[model samples]
Target: DVKVTQSSRYLVKRTGEKVFLECVQDMDHENMFWYRQDPGLGLRLIYFSYDVKMKEKGDIPEGYSVSREKKERFSLILESASTNQTSMYLCASSSSGTGGSATNEKLFFGSGTQLSVL
Candidate 1:
């Protein structure tokens, strides 16, 4: 079975501290994504990588960045944490489908990291 593990399930940080959210997938998936879930905003994509050292900016990438140095590991970096950035951070991985399209791929999500910024 495919498993996605997040380093932290709950976290609290100061407003200006740098936060690192780590994720690792057991399966050799080619795509990894970072998403933040808010009360009314739903799941907003922050960053995604299709391959190692390759990253694509998603909908809300202003305050975030990602690193995929290995096939099974993806890290989300919050350069300067802010109050508004506090939310549930989720890491997901999916294997590329027939044409490398994600439309039909099954996503495996981590338990999630609930970050509280003060």
Candidate 2:
């Protein structure tokens, strides 16, 4: 089965520290995405890479960036972690298959990275 793995399930850091969140997918998927899940705000995209060395900013790409040098590995970088950034972050990927469109394929997600900043 395809699985997405996040570097951490929980993390706490002081304000202004930089943070790196790693995500790896077992499936040879070409699309990877990062999103922050907040209580009332729902999942907001940060960044996404459709192929290695190529990326695009999502809806809420401010204060964040992404890397996808390898086919199966993608990374999310928080330039300066702040208290307001504390939230549940999820990494996901998709591959073409029985599903009609990429969206229909559905994203396989990592449990999530719960970041806490103080």
Candidate 3:
């Protein structure tokens, strides 16, 4: 079974402070993603790394950054936390696909991290 572990289940911080959310996946998947879920915006991808040391920006990359130093680890960094940044953050991992029809593979997700900035 694939397991995605998020370091924090809940976090609270005041505005202007820096925040770091960590995620680790046991499976040696080639793709890892970070997304933030909001009521109206839905799940917006922040960043994703297809391979170690290779990262691509997603739709909402502003105010966020990601690091994939190892195959099993990916981290999301918030330079300066703000009230508007408060949301439910999700980390997911999935393989590039084996057979020819692997493009539709499902992504395994972590429980989630709810961040609140005052």
- Cα lDDT computed for each candidate against the true fold: 0.94, 0.92, 0.94
Model 3 per-residue lDDT tens digits across residues 20-50? 9999999889999999999988899999999
**Candidate number achieving the greatest TM-score relative to the actual structure:** 3
In Å, residue 20's CA in model 3 sits off its true spot by 0.5
Error of 1 at 8 (Å): 0.2
- TM, every model: 0.94, 0.93, 0.95
**Residue 86, model 1, lDDT:** 85
Give the lDDT of residue 59 in candidate 2.
Answer: 98
Q: Tell me the number of clashing residue pairs for each predicted model.
A: 0, 0, 0
Q: Could you give candidate 2's per-residue lDDT for residues 1-118 as a string of tens digits?
A: 8899999999999888989999999989988999999999999999999899999999999889888999899999999998889999999998755546555568899999999999
- TM-score-wise, the better of 2 and 3 is 3
User: On residues 3-114, what C-alpha lDDT tens digit does candidate 1 reach at each position?
Assistant: 9999999999999999999999998999999999999889999999999999999999998888899999999999999999989999999988888676759888999999
Model 3, residue 4: C-alpha shift (Å): 0.4
Instruction: Tell me the lDDT of model 1 at 71.
Output: 91
Tell how far residue 21 is off in model 1, in angstroms. Answer: 0.3
Return the number of clashes found in candidate 1.
0
